[model samples]
Target chain A: MKSFLQPEQWTMAAASHWLLVTTVLLSVMACSSVPAPVAELAAAEQAILTAEQARVNTYAASELAQARQKLQDARAAVVQKDMLQASRLAQQSKLDAELALARAGAAEALAVNDEMKKSTEILQQEMLRNQTGVKP
Target chain B: MNYLKRSAPTAVAAAMSLMLLGACASKPATPEGVINARQQLNKLQASADLAVLAPVAIRQADAAVQEAEKPTKDQALSDHLVFIADRKVNIAWAQAQDKHAQDQRKLLTDARDAARLDSRTREADLARSDASVARNDAERARDEAVAARTAAEQERMAAEQARSGAEQDRLAAEQARNAAALSQQEAESANAKAAALQAQIAALNAKTTERGLVVTLGDVLFDTAQSNLKASSSSHLANLAAFLKSYPERGVIIEGHSDSVGDEDYNFGLSQRRADSVQGYLLGQGIAASRITTAGKGESLPVAGNDNASGRQQNRRGEVIITDAVTASN
Candidate 1:
């Protein structure tokens, strides 16, 4: 039983070693051929930073969180030596951060518009009272 | 077994060298992006509005900061996490501010509605008060009109009373004036009657005495020593009868007288017969018999002495006396 097992084990070990070598060679080749997603990562980081300055974290919290998660996925892809996936994730993160900033501005403007509408209602009531000669 | 021992020592040496190289490459200093993200997170958490209105957002921002602070070999990935964390913190602060402004607008709207209701209630109260005043004024005017009518009625009654009194006074004055005029007319008529009676007595050659009116017939009115009246002297007796007829309220007295030439007894008889004759003649001429009385006077009541013819002539005569209603009683 030992003599039979030793041959099979040696064959298994040789196969594992060849697979390991092939995986390492493929990883090296992929790293050498693909460019780093440095520009896309920088754009995603700059967009999220601009959203923070514009108060998007509070007004568009869900969108800002989604942008942050996409940027993290992009960094993980870079570490895995998948430059195409990393660049795609970084671009998506930049667009998501820009959307979060626009949503924050839109929400703030909507709140302002609601307040202005209430003021106009009060002004109209005062004018009616004056026209009718009713004391206030 | 010999190949495994040799390979194991080689793997151990490689592992140790690899660990040393990793130690040299690792960054111990905190990244500037991570520090800025932490500061932003702390500012959001400290806000009073973020704790209540934006609690969920603040918690999300805190989680992002923690993720950003995690150690990583990739510098680009660490910077990206820090940027997202800062944006999350700003989102919490903006939500809190917007909510506060909305509450203020609601408060102003409520105040405006309350003021409008109060103004309408005041206007209704003023209208009710004015209506009450108008009703009172109308009632006063009606009362005044009633009072004026009562006063006019009283004045009319007073005027009626005054007119009745004046009419009574005028009737009394008219009655008194009529009585005075009647008395004056009666007095004047009585005076005229008295004057006409005096003229009739004068035409008979009568003299008024204390007793009545007296008329004398001379001796020539009769024949000498005769009892009969002559026709030429009958006119005097007729005129006397007419005066007696006109004055029916009078009575007459007859007297006879003679001269002394005759015997005493015979002369008395002749004087009596002569007086009777004159009275009988007056009665035949329409004088009431009850209005005459007769008497004779012989030598005892002669007007002259028998010595002279003129004296004897005057002594032979007949006389008549008429008595008024007042003198006849005596």
Candidate 2:
């Protein structure tokens, strides 16, 4: 409530406001001029590479294709200067690649489970038959 | 670097919202993609068995869902967040399921091992029992064989005993038959001897009486009054002597009788002399002297009345008595 403003304080405050304005303008310019989502894009590409390495393209081809498409779309967004969309699309691409890898792994795991189940069943049946055969 | 990129977008988005705030009076609902992502994440989180399996992935998925659920005016950004969230949730689930399946494989492996071990154990048990059964059968067979051998041995011994008993019985019967034959031969010989003795007695003209066989010699067998055996009686005396020789146990008693003539003492003396003459004749024929005896009866014991010459002649006789013939022949 007391009037504590002085001339030097006002001069310093105004100088600070100009600096702040300059900083805002610079940040706004940086935002509008779309820096490509280089890290996110690289992450997505890396995820795709990992999925391909895992042979996800063979088992989860559709998901892998979608991930590839999303990565391409992210590149297109970067070219179009839509930095936010490019980042989002890159993230989505990465997630899609991961999903493809996850799907492929799940499919192989389930198949292995089925194989084991069948093997166990065969063993059980053989045991039963052996037990029954003894009676004769 | 990524953080800076993201914050820059938020600032831009906030500015755009402020500009659009005048046109839109109310806030927008959460995007369908975000709702879908939230639903998927909720399902993943509800699974306790799956949630704990991939802790880092689940945490990432949770963060993605929360970011997607944040009310944002940017449709593209919301869609990207939703997709990332959905994929992350699905990835978490896939990873959890993979881990779960691998974990289950351990149990399955154990089960398979158990089954294999159990099968092996059963086979071993069966083989062992079979061996035991075979052993029992073999032992039983051995025991039966031993019992059979024992029975056979006992039967053989019994047969041997029976054969020996039969042989003993046959031998006894043969001995009895031999004894019977010997006795029969002795009896036949005795009967023949009795017949021969009877013939000898008849030849002697001996008479049987209570005393024994009696052979009487007429007075002519002696000299008129002298005591001497006449030669005419030699044949009859020889027969008697032969009988006495054949039966050595026979004892002779010679008695002399006379007619009522002369003095009694003189008559007795004459008879005694006549008995002595017969005994002397028997002794000459080889009769034992110990088996011969002589006695004389005077005219008082005459067999007929001495009033007639015939009666007197009948009374004047020497009698040879075989006293022990019946007893000695037995």
Clashing residue pairs, backbone N/CA/C < 3 A, model 1? A52-B87, A57-B87, A57-B88, A57-B91, A58-B91, A58-B92
User: Per-residue alpha-carbon lDDT of model 1 for B242-293, expressed as tens digits?
Assistant: 8888888888888788888879888877888888998899889887778888
| Model 2 per-residue lDDT tens digits across residues B1-330 | 899887998989898998799477668767777677677777877888887888899899889888888888788677777877888888988898888888788888888778777777767777888899999999999999999999999999999999999999899889889889988988889899889988888888888988678888888787667788778878767888888888887788888888888888999999998888888888888777788888888786777888988888888998888866534421
Q: Tell me the native contact fraction for each prediction.
A: 0.00, 0.61
TM-score (all chains, Cα) for each model: 0.38, 0.56
Deviation from native of the Cα of residue B147 in model 2, angstroms: 6.9
Worst 10 residues of 2 chain B by lDDT: B321-330
Best by TM-score: 2
Q: For each candidate, what is the lDDT?
A: 0.73, 0.79
lDDT for each residue of candidate 1 in A48-108, tens digit (9 for 90 to 100) = 7678778877778988898889988877776677777788688768767876875686577
Give the TM-score of chain A, superposed on the true chain A, for all candidates in the order listed: 0.70, 0.70
Compared with the true structure, the alpha-carbon lDDT of candidate 2 equals 0.79
